[model samples]
Target: MTKKVLITGFTGQVGSQLADFLLDQTDYEVVGMMRWQEPMDNLYDLTGRINNKERVSVFYADLNDFSAIARMLEEVRPDFIYHLAAQSYPKTSFNIPIETLQTNIIGTANLLEGIRQLKEKNGFDPVVHVCSSSEVYGRAKPGEVLNEDTKFHGASPYSISKIGTDYLGQFYGEAYGIKTFVTRMGTHSGPKRSDVFFESTVAKQIALIEAGFQEPIIKVGNLSSVRTFQDARDAVRAYYLLSQESYKGNVPCGETFNIAGEDAYKLPEVIDLLLSFSSRHDIKVETDSERLRPIDADYQMFDNTKIKSFIDWEPEIPTSKMFKDLLDHWRDEIKKGKVPLNR
Candidate 1:
């Protein structure tokens, strides 16, 4: 029988892209775990395949609902699990801190507990990749490069939640002997990038400006932070390779790696670059106070040396291509009469 793989959050940008990668490159059956009524926008292209059950299927299970997650685990019994579901937006986490914490922190524990119980009973040993965020290194000191060992400083409620989630991934593996590893992926973007994020919002605004949907003023928040960018495509590739390594028993349980791109840039430079791809050259930048977060991850330089040594991976997609693709994605969305609201 072909091995089954479960991907949580398979309806979101990274999750959907990871599903695409698995479909294109592997023979494994893809089981996507998502909550009922989650947006299907990202996975629209795979609707036909998902409906046909052609190596793809959807399982309705919310992470917060332990019974649902447990039942899914029992039924699916996947050979690999890529846990990527979470309340992923930092700024939004501020307004809904309690919900964010509950969903990200406790939600992760529910999944891990299910795995632990199933593993003890049935010897189910799936290679699990617990996805964490570089945001856990929130409010990094200037000029510091974050690695796996860096002491975490939660800058926002979302970051604090991820710190809990990160610890839970390692705790489950070490305490229960589950085959799992955690990844702290740096700021990643490309097509389907959400408008709430800095780079994507600029790209969306530019697309809107080009389409005459809005004025040429690009509204933004704080742009003083410095960070690296990677394509979600490349990040998912790294995740795949790490899963394979874990399956082969090459990766220690709960081992953490920093997967990020090498290219670094200031926020303003990103806006300039995205604007350079626009049809309209008259666009101007304006500061929007509402867009600013209460507390932000002001610096996110990462040390990806560990991941490179484990897996033959470095970011292959250029920042230029990623930005252009994001802009074009918005343009295509607008053309389809799916006008995005200005945030």
Candidate 2:
């Protein structure tokens, strides 16, 4: 029988790309879990296939609702569950801390709790991938290489929420014998990246300027932080490989890994790279205090050794190409008459 994999946050860049990867590369039947009103922009290519139920389908449910999730699990009983849904924006969390906490922390607990009940009743065991963020290690010391053992300093409410989500993943696995593994992925971005993100917003502004929809000035926030950038596609591949490793018993349940790119760059360099890809040469850069985070992660250098020892995975796409793709994605969106706001 063909195995099924459940992917929450099915409309986001990584989730949508994971659906594509599974459909194209593996025989797994893809069950995408999303809310009823979720936008299909990221999953446009799969809409027809999804509608036909051609090895892909969507399950309407929210992580906060344990009953709905339990119902879905009872019917689907997926071989793998990729828990990717969360209040993912770090800056937005400052304003909506309660919702972020409820959605990420409580929401994750709801999912695991439902699964624990299902396992107790039905003896269902599935490989679960809990998505965590590198933001858990906020404001690392200068030039420090973050590993799984690094202390978590919550720089923002979102980071704090993710810390709770991370602990729940380990707790569920260690306490209940769920085949779960956690990943702290560093700064992954690419095409279909939301404009709220730093790199994607710059690309969007540049595209708008090229389309004569905005002024030549690109507003930005603090650019002092250093980070390792990887394409979302590459990150999803690591996710898939790690899931198989967990299932094969090569990885211990509840163990954590830092999946990231090798090269690190300051924020300004990333901005410059995006600017270099733009069609307009006269675009100016301006600092926008409104966009700066209240508390920032100054350094995000992560070590990928722990993941590599168990799985054969590494970043494949170049960051330069990722910037180009992001710029082009917005350009294509503009051409589709989708005039985005100057965010």
Candidate 3:
């Protein structure tokens, strides 16, 4: 029998890629939760077009309703649950703290509660994978790379909500015997990611300039702040391994892992790399305060050795490759008249 896996946020950057990876390579039947729009049939839709209609399935639902989620859980009874849904954006969280808390904290609790109830009655205990962000670390001490043991500062509403969810998963795992694992990830970008991300912001600007959709000048923000970035595909693969290992009872349960690249890159270095890719190295770069994060970490990097040992995984695509691929993707979108000058 094919294993059934339930995933929330299947339309998102990492979730969608994860769904595709599982469906195409494994025997898992993926049932994805689509909150806003109708879910696509496969990975093709994420690439801006639909190709396969049979590889994946979707259900329209919101994450806030525990009762609704309970129904879905009972029906699917998935062997593995991947929770990737969140109101994710540090700056935006300041604008909608309540919504962020409700979606991240309450929504997570709803799923944990539903799953716990289901396990008690039906004797089906599914392994859960929660995607947390490194932002949960908030402000890191100098020269201190964030590990699972790193204490959380949670300076922003977004970080606070994630910290809540992270603890919630742990509490449920210990109290209800639900196998739960958390991946507190750093910045990850790829071809299909939204331009709202910093790397994508650079890519979009370059794409616009290359396509003549905008002027040659590129707008930037906080170019001195440093961040670690990994490929979204690589990060999703780590999530899968962590979820599966914990489900099989092969690894420690109720633990968290940090997933990121080998090194942190300064914002200016990344911009320079993109400019090199676009062959527009001479292009002017200007700062825009609108893009500045409310509270910026001095430096952020993840110690992924815990996950690397547990899952036998390593980041295959380097950040430079990821940067180039993003630029190339946006350039194509621009040429196809898909990306506007200003987003």
* Candidate number achieving the greatest lDDT relative to the actual structure: 1
TM-score, each model?
0.99, 0.99, 0.93
Candidate RMSDs in Å, in order, are 0.7, 0.8, 2.3
* Model 1 lDDT per residue over 192-264, tens place: 8889999999989888888889999999999999999999999999999999999999999999999998899
Which residue window of length 10 is worst by lDDT in model 3? 46-55
Backbone-clash count (model 1) = 0
Would you give me the overall lDDT of model 1? 0.93
Compose the digit string of candidate 3's lDDT tens values, residues 1-343: 7788888987777888888788667978888787756434224554432234354576667789887899899888898899998988777788899999999999999998888888889797888988788988988876787889988988789999999999998888777778998888888898778777778888899888877777888887677667888899988888888887897797666788888877578888888889888766557889888877788765787788788888889889988889998898888877766765464
On TM-score, the stronger of 2 and 3 is 2
State the lDDT at 69 in candidate 1. Answer: 92
Candidate 2 residue spans exceeding 4 A from truth: none
lDDT of each: 0.93, 0.92, 0.82
> Which 10 successive residues of model 1 have the least lDDT summed?
274-283
lDDT of 2 by residue, 1-343 (tens): 9999999999998899999999999999999999999888999899999989999999999988988998999999999999999989999999999999999999999989988999999899999999999999998999799999999999999999999999999999999999999999899898999999889999999999999899999999888989999999999999999999888998788989899988789988998898887667898899998999999998999999989998888899998998899999999999999998787
